[model samples]
Target: MNRVDRLHSPFEQHSRALAWLAVFGLLLAATNLRGGLVVFAPLVLEIREALSLSASAFGMLTTLPLICFAVISILVPLMTRFFSSITLVVFGLLIISLGVVLRLVASYPVVILGTLLLGSAIALLNVLIPVLVKVFFPSRMGLMTGLYSIMLSLGAGMGLYLAVPMLEYFGHWHYPVMVWALLPLLTCLIWLPLLKLRGEVKPVTGARVTLWKSATAWAVTLYMGLQSFYFYAIVTWLPNILIESGLNPLEAGSTTAMISLASIPFNLFIPIFATKMHNQRSLVVLISLLSFSGLTGLWWAPQLAPMLWAALIGMGAGGALSLSLSFFILRTGDGVQATALSAMAQSLGYLLAATGPVTLALMHDISGHWLTALMLLMLLQIFQFAFGWKAAAAVQIKPDINTHSSKRTP
Candidate 1:
């Protein structure tokens, strides 16, 4: 066929339109993934006071979602047998909307119940979105991953930034928390069109690959875990830390939002840059250094340079997360393997991350200082460096699978 004829082909036009639609759906969905977990942080003080929650109880608001991610992610791969990825994502968004509404109830137990629901729904979305990226943009994994990562980071920043203001405007914390439910509902509307294309983008099926046997997969898992630990720990407590350092609740919340927002640039570009490199070991080293310096500054003189510390931590954590998500695709040979690795890495990794908020809270309660927690967080950078170096190698995790029985993701 001539070039002009090929360009005018109906198949080519349809494919381009479908690609844009898929990308739009993915980006919108990404915005809902983290905002629910993050929006609660800035309003912690008001909620705790109203609910009479202890530190551990207050911590549950954030930790519950991570716990759900750890547990629910393992089952997502199996869910593919019954539902397409698009259906699962749409279901998750609806559930997330319900969870958000449930959380707005004035009762504490009801709040916890809502949080559990929300977390469970987010867990499903988390495991499958990358699978969608792998399925839809196999040749451009880095660019697509970066786009979604940026959306996640943007969601988090907006949640943190808007929560306090919403609280002020609504004259209550519940309303501020409840407002986030709209996002998932709106995203669900965006995603509904993809359901029609379900046959074209089914999930990986057949015999499951054993990613646990791969050392590189384990390294990626650990890298994901440590990076998550750092990010969640900061998200949960940074506002309180700033408060302790003499910032008012508003200032603390805004500063915390700054940390989440600062990561945007790294999230936008890191994956793209990493994909062009032979390996990402140097990037990992750079991540560790930035995090170390930020933590040190926070520990020593937070009041003097809170925004600077926030930016450094944001950049480090953002780059590390974008890279880790890329690793699920980069280190794996195909969609089936990417799904398996994502399941393993996120399940085990988030289980480890789930401990960060409560652990930091306990460390503070026991020592009556944030320094102990800060020290523990700083020490984690060393492990991040080690695992990231291993995970960043130009190595693909080759899982043993029965090719004849196994189904490739669309």
Candidate 2:
């Protein structure tokens, strides 16, 4: 049997109602990953004015969480050794809740500290969610992945579209940030019941897979990094680009939300679509072109056709992000290996991504034109396409099957 066949033991049967409940729990957890990340961008100008932040300082606010993702990712796989995955996820949710509440303190240091806490918290789930699919839903990987990606995109959209109204009602940025805490709180209430689940695998004690030696793993990592770099950088600056191109603040904000909305359907569609094929090179090629077209359009004529460009990037980014998440399982042997590969990709991947916001800001600051930055983003899409295609190859990672089989409980 193939490595994929070996690592993916069938999920132990559960009641239909219980399976749906697990799906509910997965979707709930996925929602929090990108919700808070979107809150800051809409409030960027307000945050800068209120806090008296310099350009680079504001950039750091954007960069900090990604740095946290990188730093925290290094420890998550190891963390699974000591804690059950469900327990670790519960801890992550609480940390996210704490971080959200922390942002309400109205002090710079405290707010920064809160942001760090939640970013670190989200970082843990980032590694785990894909693993969840591998461990528990190997039979439903693509559907679950797309569903998870859609939930995250919706979270981002909620954070974006809801911010203005939230500002109107709450009368301050801090309150909206405070409102985000409710998502984790809600997810925790739902997830808490699952901790009592019987027959789940306990943490295994053994040597971990050495992923650094694998080319497909590195392909997954770079694909994750470059796609994140583009998505975060574009989301951060696209509003400003639209505003400069003659859109009003409201329109620019709306356009930004639309980009995320566009991605939603694509995110839902891509993984399921990609799974029907042997390799996803064609999907990668399509995304690269869509990305190139949309980004270049924004650079050259954003004012002339804002919705068109936004939709292009939206679809492109959505498919790309879903594909990247899909690779966590596609390239690895099982949920355990998925967690390890996730750690490597996201730890290093996010560090690479960490530079996107700050680096783009610095580039724009130096050049005084969006052209240079947009051009660079377009160029990177090609590079991203390379990694995406290779990572989608027919060959899978050659894991230590003998050791892993002995260690994992059936």
Candidate 3:
């Protein structure tokens, strides 16, 4: 088919119904990405106590899923090439559901293995959903992206907040972990109808959309990586940091829950505002400044009004993340470029991003303090600011041949 034919075909018949269905599916998939990761964060103390794990062992448990995320991200593009995005999504949900169920069995090895499986599933789904947004909801990319990001943050916040209560009600960690399985299972059922509808959709092909050579692409990827690094590191370690700062377990958990909850509004609002701007660099600077301020407040002035600082950090981080996803759709010329850039940015970006939590965990294990870890996170924000400035310049990624010819290089 010709270019116009390809563009018009996907929406020719069932556009409205299909768009709604795709949005629903995207929200469900996005919701699942952090269920496994955050649900366990609030339960870290219980796991450590029950398993009698050392500091290093506890750190390993937190870091393993991120490692899996990085590894699985590398494989997603190849997997999508052979399988339909719908098929990959369904398979990812299945794996995540199975992993959640397996966690109930609760051998140490089994728990770690389940975490890996969950991360792998999340990695695949994370990469595919943006491609779907680009393909189906081209007109409402910012709105849909914001909606999905809010759902993701809400799911994560709820997962962390509810875990202790769920365990308290059920009298065991197994049920708390197992309860999340129902989400993906329900998502899988809702998505089953799409299986029959798959082969009817045409496949993407040709020039590969070459995002690797683009400066805008690299800048966005680095920004994504840096922001993710800080977010995950803080999520994984903040409760412990609070505990070290003299709060009891319940108080620390509550603080972390509040931070996660605060992210929802910011995630929803940031992209909407960023999309309206002629260029996004000022917003990027604003977000980075907010995040740095929050982190500094948390480290230096723990005795001050901590929740306010925490909320500021949450808002900034959430905004940064939502904007990163928004840029994935906004910076591209077409669905093909969106797909390639999404795969490239998320795969390599997540690989780099995964290092933050692991590094924080290692520092906590070795130095027996959270100060060094917090400093490292502050340093990451510097990189985030630099790259985000370039990414928000409103420039598009064109071919190197055209770029060079236009520049008249010496």
Candidate 4:
């Protein structure tokens, strides 16, 4: 795709009102994505005992959303065939609201069903945001990314902090879970105007196309997956890990909150910083070392330097999250291919992430300690470093070379 094809307008930019609405809606929608998932971290132990579930079973609950992301990703290309990304986001918000309500039923089956629904809902937004950014904020991808990503970080941080308080005030877990339903509902109202602004036009020339010819695409995908692998694994188990090391539930939750907070600055600034640089390989290397040291410190001295280790992990891992999203646009030529690459990366990445919780939980079960599990996380950082080297290369993922397969993506 040339400059004209890559930069084609998805919506007219003459209306200041519509532009503001899109920005507002985009940030609000981002805030909702991780709230549904983060709510489980602070309450995992209470939830485990309440449900009478085994470690393995609880792991499944945490992993269900990622599993949903993986499964639903294959359908994204198909879903876009009928609906614009703006319209798709509205539908996602509705499904998330419905799923939040379903979670209040308190039955095991009902809760699992709700999780599946919400996970699938988040999957749509996760895969669609890059495409929408390409359409609406092409010239300001980094700044816009930082804005939405900070919201993601804040939502996640605040979610962990609010979980216990909400539980205390509501006197039950179900009510707190249902409160998030309002976010998406309000977001829907804000997003509805976007469809009118888009004028129902769609881009089809680059539809269903992928960057299979370039090795950078695979590198970006692997980096995305490996970072997610460590992140989800840590979030699901870190509180418990701290508790096992002698902290109370409050302290454990505090550490989790601190970790989330630490990542916020990085999430808000990494994209903008990256866009101004030659390559992000050095940033990746710096964060990897920080994460490696943090994980080591946690394993060796959980009580000592808890805040420092958490911050390091946050900058390393949380920073990785922003970088991964930035790479989607940075490494791709245009919005159309960015969508294709984002869909491919997130689909497989989250699927790869679905294993994090279970794998760590199982490792603990077999070894009777978190050492084996922590070591596994440490090893993943090395892999992330290797892949980030190529992904952060100064090249775009165009179809420069051919790599054939029996099947095609459409």
Candidate 5:
């Protein structure tokens, strides 16, 4: 058989069983994606005290992964030329496990090294998972995107909720962090079976598409960046905003939970719904309005209906994230193009995202209140709507690539 026929033969014969395996492995991998980074978040104070880190040092430790994401993502497309997406994912997970173990050594230099390794490993997974989705489940892009997107949020939530408990159970901050290594390790095992299927799926070799020069690619990148920025800033500051608005620590904590919880269902559904439509512009506008209205409520009268406002922001942020990810697949012609766009969007997008929390903090410091910061965020939603609208157009990165195998919902 020819190479194309060889690629199609196994899939055409055993599509159902292979698809189930692919979906399971993809979801399991998704669970490990964000959990490692967020697991560090809830353990921050404990880690800082244990490691004797200064506030700035601790901030850098937390920020390092985001910087890695921005830097490492740009290199993923290059790596694809040498390895299949599955191989990179498997290697990345093991590296993450090693990084987790290294951090438990309790030495400052060791911890920095470990954090760097963790960030670099995750950066690989971040850029390539969508490429896998496009390769294996092109026909169900929205459904698979939505499912993995929900898993990402689920993983983060589980990490946040479980981190302190793990610390208490192990009686050391190191052990709590170390225990998270189990996730990637386990996920690594789940993906092992897929390696044998690699013969059916090789990296796409084509004339390089210059994502940087495409206005549509830029639109997708900006949409991805602004939505990510809003998410990180709100997550970092919402509690403080609540406390400043006269709520007790307990109340603020509960409100934050409400925000996290509210996003789950929307994350579960929005991408699936978006893909079935003719275009996602309406969804983008809807998400921006929800975030804008929520931010307005928080700025003007947060005490009035905190839960309502929080939920709206959560839904908006969650939906925007899933939609932006969908753009990586929706806007591309094939898995190769998707990988390039995903790398470009995440590299620049996360570099922009890396600035989010710090910028908000700086604004609050300069203005002596969060009103200015909140207003700035509200203004950003306007730009998010504009870029997201352009990105939401029904088109492809390579118009000449045949799309018969991956038709959109009519």
Candidate 6:
């Protein structure tokens, strides 16, 4: 029998079991991506107290992981080329687990290093996920993407809300960090079966396509990067911003947690709706309006029922994120393009996005306020709206079947 037939042969006897295993494995991997970031955010003060770090140092603590995430994302395609996606994903989880363990055992400098390792692992997993969806759930891209995104959001929220309580119960920050190690470790266990499934089948070979020449490709990358820029900026600094605006630290963290909770619904619903629509333009416009309105509310009247504004922003951001993941699948004609596009968009976009939090911090440091920073963010949203309009239109990246020559224009 041929290779494709051999791959399917095992499935004939255990297709149902393998299908459920793939779904569960994907969910577990998705849930671990943002846990490190969200867990660190709520515990920043405690970490600061323990390490005696300054504001700039605190900023570095947050920024280093993002920088690592961006830098490592650029290398994921290379990693995938040398190893199967399943192998890379399993390796990533192992790295993340080690990072968490290191965080518990190490000193301040070592903790920062551990964060870098964790970020790098998460970056690889992030790029691989959509490719896996394309491979295994070709017919259910939108639905599966939506489900994974929701799991990611919910996991992030859990990390934020549970960290402090866990620390309190355990009476040490180390326990909190150490406890999360179990997640990736568990994921590694669940994925062990799939690892054995990748026996030395001659590597499926293909010619590589250059994605930089495609306008649609660049547009999608910029949109993904800019949206991530704003999203991470908010995730890293929003609590501090809200606290500076008069809310206490607990209240600020709670508010940010609520925003994350609000995303759960939007992440689950948006992709399903986007798949039914011809183009995603209307959804883009609507979400942008909601996000802008929310930002305006936060800037102008944060004292007046800020939770409503937070929820609005969360809903819009969640929808945008889901749509971006959907575009990674929809804009590509097949798995190869999906892998390339996912790598390009996430690597370049994340590198660009790494500036957002630092820029916001610098603006605040110089101006002694967040108004100008918010205005800058609003301008980014405007650009996002413009690009989203172009990217949401139906178009596919057609690669030359013989040579893998590809271009995206329409």
Winner by TM-score: 5
Query: What do the candidate models score in CA lDDT, each in turn?
Result: 0.83, 0.81, 0.75, 0.79, 0.83, 0.77
Model 6: how far is 176 from its true place, Å?
A: 1.2
Tens-digit per-residue lDDT, 165-251, candidate 3: 998998888767776788998888778876654664434422334566888999988888888888877976888888888878878
TM-score-superior candidate, 3 or 5: 5
Q: Model 6, range 32-100, lDDT digits (tens) per residue? A: 988866687668878888887777777776677777767887766556555677788889999989887
Q: How do the residues 238-257 of candidate 5 rate in per-residue lDDT, one tens digit apiece?
A: 99999999999889878887
Kindly list the per-residue Cα lDDT of model 1 for residues 346-396, writing each as its tens digit: 998899888887799999999998988999999999998999999999988
Q: Which candidate, 2 or 3, has the higher TM-score?
A: 2
TM values, all candidates: 0.89, 0.91, 0.86, 0.89, 0.93, 0.90
Q: What TM-score does prediction 4 earn?
A: 0.89
What lDDT tens digits, residue by residue, belong to model 2 across residues 1-410? 01122233322444545555667888989989988876887788778888887777776666788889999997887787767787888889999999888766657788789889989999999998778766766767778889999998888778877887888888888777766888888888877876755247456456366678788999989999999899888987998888877899989978887778889888987888777778888888888888889998998889988999999998898989898888887877655687788899999989988788778889989999788999999999889988988998977787655545424521
Tell me the lDDT of model 2 at 20: 59
Name the better of 2 and 6 by lDDT. 2
lDDT of model 5 at position 17: 56
Candidate 5 regions with alpha-carbon error over 4 angstroms? 1-10, 13-15, 205-207, 399-410
362 in model 3: Cα distance from truth in Å?
Answer: 5.2
For model 4 the local lDDT of residue 28 reads 90
How high a TM-score does candidate 3 get? 0.86
Model 4 CA deviation exceeding 4 Å by range: 1-13, 41-59, 200-206, 400-410
Q: Which clashing pairs does model 5 show? A: none
Model 1 residue 176 CA deviation (Å) reads 3.2
| Clashes per candidate (backbone, < 3 Å) | 0, 0, 0, 0, 0, 0
**lDDT for model 5, on a 0 to 1 scale?**
0.83
Itemize residue pairs with steric clashes in candidate 1.
none
What local lDDT does model 5 show for residue 145? Answer: 87
